[model samples]
Target: MIYIACGAILLALGLIWLIKPAKKANPLYGYSSYLAQVNQGSFAFAQKKASLYFALFGLLQLLLGVGIHLLKWDRYFLIWLLTFYFFILFPIVATEKSLKQFLIKRHELPADYVDPDKVKHEKTKGFRDRK
Candidate 1:
Protein backbone atom coordinates (compact mmCIF):
# COMPACT_ATOMS: atom_id res chain seq x y z
CA MET A 1 0.00 0.00 0.00
CA ILE A 2 2.86 2.37 0.82
CA TYR A 3 4.64 1.67 -2.43
CA ILE A 4 1.42 2.11 -4.34
CA ALA A 5 0.88 5.42 -2.62
CA CYS A 6 4.42 6.47 -3.38
CA GLY A 7 4.01 5.55 -7.01
CA ALA A 8 0.80 7.53 -7.18
CA ILE A 9 2.61 10.51 -5.70
CA LEU A 10 5.39 10.20 -8.24
CA LEU A 11 2.86 9.97 -11.02
CA ALA A 12 1.14 13.11 -9.83
CA LEU A 13 4.41 14.98 -9.71
CA GLY A 14 5.25 13.68 -13.15
CA LEU A 15 2.02 15.12 -14.45
CA ILE A 16 3.17 18.49 -13.11
CA TRP A 17 6.16 18.20 -15.43
CA LEU A 18 3.64 19.37 -18.00
CA ILE A 19 3.04 22.77 -16.30
CA LYS A 20 6.49 23.49 -14.83
CA PRO A 21 7.15 27.16 -15.34
CA ALA A 22 4.15 29.17 -14.19
CA LYS A 23 4.75 32.06 -16.55
CA LYS A 24 2.09 32.76 -19.10
CA ALA A 25 1.92 35.29 -21.98
CA ASN A 26 2.42 37.78 -19.13
CA PRO A 27 1.89 37.69 -15.38
CA LEU A 28 -0.47 40.27 -13.96
CA TYR A 29 1.06 42.59 -11.36
CA GLY A 30 -0.65 43.84 -8.22
CA TYR A 31 0.50 45.88 -5.22
CA SER A 32 -0.04 43.00 -2.83
CA SER A 33 1.78 40.70 -5.22
CA TYR A 34 5.32 39.55 -4.57
CA LEU A 35 6.01 40.97 -7.97
CA ALA A 36 4.35 44.23 -7.11
CA GLN A 37 7.52 46.16 -7.83
CA VAL A 38 8.71 44.07 -10.76
CA ASN A 39 9.38 46.03 -13.89
CA GLN A 40 10.87 45.50 -17.35
CA GLY A 41 14.35 43.93 -17.85
CA SER A 42 14.20 42.49 -14.32
CA PHE A 43 14.51 38.96 -15.56
CA ALA A 44 17.36 37.96 -13.26
CA PHE A 45 15.96 39.71 -10.21
CA ALA A 46 12.57 38.28 -10.98
CA GLN A 47 13.97 34.99 -12.07
CA LYS A 48 16.15 34.85 -8.98
CA LYS A 49 13.28 35.58 -6.64
CA ALA A 50 11.04 33.10 -8.45
CA SER A 51 13.83 30.55 -8.65
CA LEU A 52 14.63 30.99 -4.97
CA TYR A 53 11.03 30.46 -3.94
CA PHE A 54 10.65 27.64 -6.40
CA ALA A 55 13.84 25.99 -5.21
CA LEU A 56 13.02 26.51 -1.56
CA PHE A 57 9.56 25.08 -2.01
CA GLY A 58 10.86 22.38 -4.33
CA LEU A 59 13.54 21.35 -1.87
CA LEU A 60 11.07 21.32 0.96
CA GLN A 61 8.72 19.16 -1.06
CA LEU A 62 11.48 16.85 -2.22
CA LEU A 63 12.73 16.54 1.31
CA LEU A 64 9.27 15.88 2.59
CA GLY A 65 8.67 13.28 -0.10
CA VAL A 66 11.98 11.53 0.42
CA GLY A 67 11.42 11.79 4.14
CA ILE A 68 8.08 10.11 3.81
CA HIS A 69 9.59 7.33 1.77
CA LEU A 70 12.81 7.02 3.72
CA LEU A 71 12.00 8.45 7.13
CA LYS A 72 8.40 7.22 7.21
CA TRP A 73 7.10 10.68 7.93
CA ASP A 74 3.73 12.09 6.87
CA ARG A 75 2.95 10.04 3.80
CA TYR A 76 0.04 12.02 2.44
CA PHE A 77 1.66 15.38 3.01
CA LEU A 78 4.93 14.23 1.49
CA ILE A 79 3.20 12.86 -1.53
CA TRP A 80 1.32 16.09 -2.10
CA LEU A 81 4.44 18.15 -1.51
CA LEU A 82 6.31 16.01 -3.99
CA THR A 83 3.64 16.55 -6.59
CA PHE A 84 3.79 20.30 -6.04
CA TYR A 85 7.60 20.32 -6.28
CA PHE A 86 7.63 18.29 -9.48
CA PHE A 87 5.55 20.89 -11.28
CA ILE A 88 6.98 24.02 -9.66
CA LEU A 89 10.66 23.60 -8.87
CA PHE A 90 11.36 21.10 -11.61
CA PRO A 91 10.44 23.66 -14.24
CA ILE A 92 12.54 26.43 -12.73
CA VAL A 93 15.58 24.18 -12.47
CA ALA A 94 14.89 23.13 -16.03
CA THR A 95 15.23 26.74 -17.18
CA GLU A 96 18.90 25.65 -17.54
CA LYS A 97 19.66 22.17 -18.94
CA SER A 98 17.84 18.84 -18.77
CA LEU A 99 14.54 20.68 -18.76
CA LYS A 100 15.57 22.50 -21.93
CA GLN A 101 16.50 19.26 -23.63
CA PHE A 102 13.24 17.63 -22.63
CA LEU A 103 11.20 20.61 -23.68
CA ILE A 104 13.06 20.90 -27.00
CA LYS A 105 12.39 17.26 -27.74
CA ARG A 106 8.75 17.49 -26.72
CA HIS A 107 7.99 20.78 -28.55
CA GLU A 108 6.85 22.53 -25.36
CA LEU A 109 9.38 25.33 -25.45
CA PRO A 110 8.75 29.06 -25.18
CA ALA A 111 9.31 31.41 -28.08
CA ASP A 112 12.23 33.97 -28.08
CA TYR A 113 13.63 32.56 -24.85
CA VAL A 114 17.24 32.09 -25.88
CA ASP A 115 20.12 31.16 -23.65
CA PRO A 116 22.04 34.21 -22.44
CA ASP A 117 25.54 35.00 -23.68
CA LYS A 118 28.70 34.78 -21.58
CA VAL A 119 28.40 38.52 -20.98
CA LYS A 120 27.38 38.51 -17.36
CA HIS A 121 27.17 42.30 -17.19
CA GLU A 122 24.76 42.56 -20.08
CA LYS A 123 22.71 39.73 -18.73
CA THR A 124 22.68 41.31 -15.27
CA LYS A 125 21.68 44.67 -16.69
CA GLY A 126 18.88 43.17 -18.69
CA PHE A 127 17.60 41.33 -15.68
CA ARG A 128 17.96 44.35 -13.41
CA ASP A 129 16.09 46.91 -15.43
CA ARG A 130 13.21 48.64 -13.54
CA LYS A 131 10.93 48.84 -16.53
Candidate 2:
Protein backbone atom coordinates (compact mmCIF):
# COMPACT_ATOMS: atom_id res chain seq x y z
CA MET A 1 0.00 0.00 0.00
CA ILE A 2 2.74 2.43 0.97
CA TYR A 3 4.71 1.62 -2.17
CA ILE A 4 1.69 2.22 -4.32
CA ALA A 5 1.07 5.58 -2.71
CA CYS A 6 4.68 6.66 -3.07
CA GLY A 7 4.79 5.53 -6.68
CA ALA A 8 1.63 7.47 -7.46
CA ILE A 9 3.08 10.62 -5.93
CA LEU A 10 6.29 10.27 -7.91
CA LEU A 11 4.40 9.72 -11.13
CA ALA A 12 2.25 12.76 -10.50
CA LEU A 13 5.25 14.96 -9.82
CA GLY A 14 7.05 13.67 -12.88
CA LEU A 15 4.06 14.40 -15.07
CA ILE A 16 3.81 17.91 -13.68
CA TRP A 17 7.45 18.56 -14.37
CA LEU A 18 7.03 17.33 -17.90
CA ILE A 19 3.92 19.42 -18.55
CA LYS A 20 5.36 22.70 -17.29
CA PRO A 21 8.98 22.96 -16.37
CA ALA A 22 10.41 26.02 -14.67
CA LYS A 23 11.68 28.55 -17.23
CA LYS A 24 14.37 29.93 -14.99
CA ALA A 25 16.80 28.52 -12.48
CA ASN A 26 14.99 28.93 -9.16
CA PRO A 27 15.75 27.04 -5.98
CA LEU A 28 12.08 26.48 -5.20
CA TYR A 29 11.21 24.24 -8.17
CA GLY A 30 12.47 22.02 -11.00
CA TYR A 31 15.62 19.90 -11.01
CA SER A 32 17.94 22.38 -9.36
CA SER A 33 21.37 20.82 -9.13
CA TYR A 34 24.69 22.69 -9.26
CA LEU A 35 25.45 21.49 -12.79
CA ALA A 36 21.88 21.90 -13.98
CA GLN A 37 21.66 25.43 -12.60
CA VAL A 38 24.87 26.44 -14.31
CA ASN A 39 23.10 27.65 -17.46
CA GLN A 40 19.71 27.84 -19.11
CA GLY A 41 20.55 25.08 -21.56
CA SER A 42 21.64 22.66 -18.87
CA PHE A 43 18.66 23.54 -16.71
CA ALA A 44 16.21 22.91 -19.52
CA PHE A 45 17.90 19.67 -20.54
CA ALA A 46 18.01 18.42 -16.97
CA GLN A 47 14.34 19.15 -16.39
CA LYS A 48 13.26 17.32 -19.52
CA LYS A 49 15.54 14.32 -18.96
CA ALA A 50 14.72 14.11 -15.28
CA SER A 51 11.02 14.14 -15.99
CA LEU A 52 11.29 11.19 -18.38
CA TYR A 53 13.50 9.16 -16.08
CA PHE A 54 11.31 9.87 -13.07
CA ALA A 55 8.14 8.92 -14.89
CA LEU A 56 9.68 5.66 -16.13
CA PHE A 57 10.96 4.78 -12.65
CA GLY A 58 7.66 5.66 -11.06
CA LEU A 59 5.77 3.34 -13.39
CA LEU A 60 8.22 0.57 -12.67
CA GLN A 61 7.77 1.12 -8.95
CA LEU A 62 4.02 0.96 -9.24
CA LEU A 63 4.23 -2.40 -11.03
CA LEU A 64 6.73 -3.75 -8.55
CA GLY A 65 4.52 -2.73 -5.66
CA VAL A 66 1.57 -4.49 -7.24
CA GLY A 67 3.61 -7.64 -7.78
CA ILE A 68 4.89 -7.63 -4.21
CA HIS A 69 1.39 -7.27 -2.84
CA LEU A 70 -0.02 -10.02 -5.06
CA LEU A 71 2.81 -12.41 -4.11
CA LYS A 72 2.39 -11.71 -0.38
CA TRP A 73 5.96 -10.52 0.09
CA ASP A 74 5.15 -8.69 3.31
CA ARG A 75 7.53 -10.96 5.17
CA TYR A 76 10.50 -9.36 3.44
CA PHE A 77 9.61 -5.83 4.36
CA LEU A 78 13.22 -4.66 4.62
CA ILE A 79 14.04 -5.73 1.10
CA TRP A 80 11.00 -3.97 -0.28
CA LEU A 81 11.84 -0.85 1.72
CA LEU A 82 15.33 -0.75 0.24
CA THR A 83 13.92 -1.23 -3.22
CA PHE A 84 11.61 1.70 -2.69
CA TYR A 85 14.51 3.90 -1.71
CA PHE A 86 16.44 2.75 -4.78
CA PHE A 87 13.62 3.69 -7.08
CA ILE A 88 13.42 7.14 -5.50
CA LEU A 89 17.17 7.90 -5.62
CA PHE A 90 18.21 6.19 -8.84
CA PRO A 91 16.48 8.70 -11.12
CA ILE A 92 18.32 11.65 -9.63
CA VAL A 93 21.66 9.91 -10.05
CA ALA A 94 20.85 8.94 -13.61
CA THR A 95 19.78 12.47 -14.46
CA GLU A 96 22.95 13.92 -13.00
CA LYS A 97 25.11 11.54 -14.96
CA SER A 98 23.30 12.37 -18.18
CA LEU A 99 23.53 16.07 -17.39
CA LYS A 100 27.30 15.71 -16.93
CA GLN A 101 27.56 14.09 -20.31
CA PHE A 102 25.55 16.92 -21.85
CA LEU A 103 27.77 19.55 -20.29
CA ILE A 104 30.85 17.76 -21.48
CA LYS A 105 29.53 17.74 -25.01
CA ARG A 106 28.67 21.42 -24.85
CA HIS A 107 32.16 22.20 -23.56
CA GLU A 108 33.69 20.57 -26.58
CA LEU A 109 32.66 23.53 -28.66
CA PRO A 110 35.30 26.04 -29.79
CA ALA A 111 36.24 28.92 -27.50
CA ASP A 112 34.51 31.45 -29.72
CA TYR A 113 31.37 29.40 -30.12
CA VAL A 114 28.15 31.20 -29.24
CA ASP A 115 24.86 29.64 -28.23
CA PRO A 116 22.12 31.05 -30.44
CA ASP A 117 19.51 30.40 -27.77
CA LYS A 118 21.33 32.54 -25.22
CA VAL A 119 21.82 35.29 -27.74
CA LYS A 120 18.14 35.36 -28.60
CA HIS A 121 17.17 35.41 -24.93
CA GLU A 122 19.52 38.28 -24.19
CA LYS A 123 18.23 40.26 -27.14
CA THR A 124 14.63 40.07 -25.92
CA LYS A 125 15.42 41.79 -22.61
CA GLY A 126 17.45 44.77 -21.51
CA PHE A 127 20.45 44.52 -19.16
CA ARG A 128 18.44 45.70 -16.14
CA ASP A 129 15.70 43.16 -16.87
CA ARG A 130 17.68 40.36 -15.26
CA LYS A 131 15.64 37.94 -13.17
Candidate 3:
Protein backbone atom coordinates (compact mmCIF):
# COMPACT_ATOMS: atom_id res chain seq x y z
CA MET A 1 0.00 0.00 0.00
CA ILE A 2 2.75 2.42 0.97
CA TYR A 3 4.86 1.37 -1.99
CA ILE A 4 1.97 1.85 -4.35
CA ALA A 5 1.27 5.30 -2.96
CA CYS A 6 4.90 6.37 -3.17
CA GLY A 7 5.20 4.97 -6.68
CA ALA A 8 2.12 6.82 -7.84
CA ILE A 9 3.36 10.07 -6.38
CA LEU A 10 6.75 9.71 -8.06
CA LEU A 11 5.17 8.79 -11.39
CA ALA A 12 2.81 11.74 -11.23
CA LEU A 13 5.60 14.17 -10.36
CA GLY A 14 7.76 12.77 -13.15
CA LEU A 15 5.00 13.21 -15.70
CA ILE A 16 4.32 16.73 -14.48
CA TRP A 17 7.99 17.65 -14.81
CA LEU A 18 8.09 16.12 -18.26
CA ILE A 19 4.99 17.95 -19.46
CA LYS A 20 5.85 21.34 -17.94
CA PRO A 21 9.46 21.65 -16.94
CA ALA A 22 10.77 24.80 -15.31
CA LYS A 23 11.75 27.31 -17.98
CA LYS A 24 14.57 28.83 -16.00
CA ALA A 25 17.11 28.01 -13.28
CA ASN A 26 15.05 29.19 -10.37
CA PRO A 27 15.60 27.78 -6.87
CA LEU A 28 11.85 27.40 -6.38
CA TYR A 29 11.40 24.28 -8.59
CA GLY A 30 12.87 21.71 -10.97
CA TYR A 31 16.32 20.12 -10.83
CA SER A 32 18.51 22.70 -9.14
CA SER A 33 21.98 21.16 -8.93
CA TYR A 34 24.91 23.52 -9.20
CA LEU A 35 25.83 22.31 -12.69
CA ALA A 36 22.23 22.40 -13.83
CA GLN A 37 21.84 25.94 -12.48
CA VAL A 38 25.05 27.06 -14.19
CA ASN A 39 23.27 28.17 -17.36
CA GLN A 40 19.99 28.04 -19.23
CA GLY A 41 21.27 25.31 -21.51
CA SER A 42 22.33 23.11 -18.60
CA PHE A 43 19.01 23.65 -16.83
CA ALA A 44 17.03 22.68 -19.92
CA PHE A 45 19.16 19.65 -20.56
CA ALA A 46 19.03 18.52 -16.94
CA GLN A 47 15.27 18.95 -16.75
CA LYS A 48 14.71 16.81 -19.83
CA LYS A 49 17.14 14.12 -18.76
CA ALA A 50 15.94 14.13 -15.16
CA SER A 51 12.33 13.80 -16.26
CA LEU A 52 13.10 10.75 -18.37
CA TYR A 53 15.06 9.08 -15.56
CA PHE A 54 12.38 9.89 -13.02
CA ALA A 55 9.63 8.51 -15.20
CA LEU A 56 11.58 5.36 -15.85
CA PHE A 57 12.41 4.83 -12.19
CA GLY A 58 8.89 5.57 -11.12
CA LEU A 59 7.52 2.95 -13.47
CA LEU A 60 10.04 0.46 -12.18
CA GLN A 61 9.07 1.24 -8.62
CA LEU A 62 5.40 0.83 -9.40
CA LEU A 63 6.05 -2.55 -10.97
CA LEU A 64 8.17 -3.64 -8.04
CA GLY A 65 5.48 -2.64 -5.63
CA VAL A 66 2.92 -4.66 -7.53
CA GLY A 67 5.23 -7.62 -7.67
CA ILE A 68 5.94 -7.47 -3.96
CA HIS A 69 2.29 -7.32 -3.18
CA LEU A 70 1.52 -10.29 -5.34
CA LEU A 71 4.44 -12.33 -4.02
CA LYS A 72 3.59 -11.62 -0.37
CA TRP A 73 7.01 -10.15 0.19
CA ASP A 74 5.68 -7.30 2.27
CA ARG A 75 6.36 -9.41 5.37
CA TYR A 76 10.03 -8.70 4.93
CA PHE A 77 9.67 -5.12 6.02
CA LEU A 78 13.41 -4.39 6.27
CA ILE A 79 14.13 -5.49 2.72
CA TRP A 80 11.28 -3.48 1.33
CA LEU A 81 12.36 -0.51 3.37
CA LEU A 82 15.86 -0.66 1.91
CA THR A 83 14.43 -1.12 -1.56
CA PHE A 84 12.25 1.94 -1.11
CA TYR A 85 15.20 4.00 0.00
CA PHE A 86 17.21 2.84 -2.98
CA PHE A 87 14.48 3.80 -5.40
CA ILE A 88 14.17 7.19 -3.77
CA LEU A 89 17.89 8.02 -3.85
CA PHE A 90 19.09 6.38 -7.06
CA PRO A 91 17.18 8.67 -9.39
CA ILE A 92 18.75 11.80 -7.95
CA VAL A 93 22.23 10.27 -8.11
CA ALA A 94 21.73 9.12 -11.68
CA THR A 95 20.40 12.50 -12.79
CA GLU A 96 23.29 14.35 -11.18
CA LYS A 97 25.85 12.02 -12.75
CA SER A 98 24.32 12.50 -16.18
CA LEU A 99 24.17 16.25 -15.67
CA LYS A 100 27.85 16.28 -14.74
CA GLN A 101 28.71 14.36 -17.87
CA PHE A 102 26.62 16.71 -19.99
CA LEU A 103 28.28 19.81 -18.52
CA ILE A 104 31.69 18.28 -19.10
CA LYS A 105 30.90 17.61 -22.75
CA ARG A 106 29.48 21.07 -23.22
CA HIS A 107 32.57 22.59 -21.69
CA GLU A 108 34.74 20.67 -24.13
CA LEU A 109 33.23 22.62 -26.99
CA PRO A 110 34.91 25.81 -28.16
CA ALA A 111 34.17 28.91 -26.10
CA ASP A 112 32.27 30.48 -29.00
CA TYR A 113 30.29 27.34 -29.70
CA VAL A 114 26.57 27.83 -30.18
CA ASP A 115 24.03 25.05 -29.91
CA PRO A 116 22.36 24.78 -33.30
CA ASP A 117 19.15 23.38 -31.84
CA LYS A 118 18.86 26.25 -29.35
CA VAL A 119 19.49 28.75 -32.15
CA LYS A 120 16.79 27.15 -34.29
CA HIS A 121 14.34 27.10 -31.36
CA GLU A 122 14.98 30.75 -30.54
CA LYS A 123 14.62 31.74 -34.17
CA THR A 124 11.32 29.95 -34.48
CA LYS A 125 9.96 31.32 -31.19
CA GLY A 126 11.45 34.80 -31.49
CA PHE A 127 12.71 34.54 -27.91
CA ARG A 128 15.44 37.05 -28.61
CA ASP A 129 12.90 39.72 -29.50
CA ARG A 130 11.29 39.62 -26.05
CA LYS A 131 12.52 41.79 -23.19
Top candidate on TM-score is 2
- Candidate 1: lDDT of 110? 62
What is the C-alpha lDDT profile of model 2 across 1-131, one tens digit per residue?
65776787778878999999988877887888877876788889999998988888888888878887999987788877766888889889889888877988888323454543467544445457765
Error of 2 at 81 (Å): 2.1
lDDT of 2: 0.80
Candidate 2: residue 73 Cα off by (Å):
1.4
**lDDT rank, highest first?**
2, 3, 1
Worst 10 residues of 3 by lDDT: 108-117
How much is 96 displaced in model 2, in angstroms? 0.4
- The global C-alpha lDDT for each of the candidates, from Candidate 1 onward, is 0.43, 0.80, 0.77
Instruction: Provide C-alpha RMSD values for all models, in order.
Output: 12.3, 12.1, 14.0
Cα error of candidate 3 at position 109, Å: 11
Q: How do the predictions measure up, each by TM-score?
A: 0.31, 0.77, 0.76
lDDT of 1 by residue, 35-69 (tens): 21233323333343444444445445555556566
Clashing pairs in 3: none
